[model samples]
Target: SDQISKDESMVGFVDDLQFFIDNRDGETVVGLKQKLEICGRGAAFNDAKKKKELFAKLLMRFERFSSAQQLFAYIMAAIHETFDTKIIPSTSSLSTQEIDAMIEAEIVDKIMAEIGEGSDHMTLNRTHIKGMIYWLADKCYVRWHCD
Candidate 1:
């Protein structure tokens, strides 16, 4: 199917992101390398299936909403800036989860400030923000650590 049709079938349920996980089939764009990067805790990250579903749903949102597409780009830029300037230069070894948490926190802070300044970015809760980060990982747009 084309992108539009796929998005039509799997629109992002922003109000209830879990709907995607509950309704997802086996379909996913997450390749082997992306999976390896995303599943940082090996078997302990047992929610890979749910994460994949959310990633797919995020793709749908990007396709369906211009605001979402803009947000995606903003998130990618933020992650690159933070990871390159801060995380990479640090001598300490941060676990993937910790790195993700730090990135998410920084992104949220930036976004909140933007919203306060009357930026056009859509407002989303923490769950939606985290979902976007995971989706970025699945799409190879960001990594929790350097390869």
Candidate 2:
């Protein structure tokens, strides 16, 4: 499930995540924060240039990985394993941008808020936004290169 589906590049970041989390010793903490700052740069869309670069890169990178099963799997994973989502809005109205936001912003915020600072709790749930979050997480964390 964590395998970036068909295109292995999607999971490139995921492979690095556990390693990054594991190696969080005293000295390397600053580097970790800096990497995370870069990791999280495109989140708010503050400037047009960075936002465009981020989206363009993602699209070019993930275009081939786009498939019905992958999308379904991503949705299912996030919903079932990661976060609690409410289905007030219908799927028909869902856009790529909104789904991206859920994965990039809301899920991380929700977990961080619930777990508090420096908490390692994996308190995820089956809710409305899980599906979107998983897909987005995979996109963010997974790499584009395959061995």
TM agreement with the true structure for every prediction: 0.52, 0.24
The residue pairs that clash in candidate 1, if any, are: none
| Candidate number with greatest lDDT | 1
- Give the Å error, residue 51, model 1: 4.6
In the order shown, the candidates' Cα RMSDs to the true structure are 9.7, 16.5
Best candidate (score: TM-score): 1
Candidate 2 residues 25-97, lDDT tens each?
Answer: 3332232223224434333333333433453354345443323234334433433343324321322355545
Superposed by TM-score, candidate 2 places the C-alpha of residue 3 at a distance from the truth, in angstroms, of 30
Q: Least lDDT summed over 10 consecutive residues: which range in candidate 1?
A: 15-24
TM-score of model number 2: 0.24
* Superposed Cα deviation of residue 67, candidate 2 (Å): 36
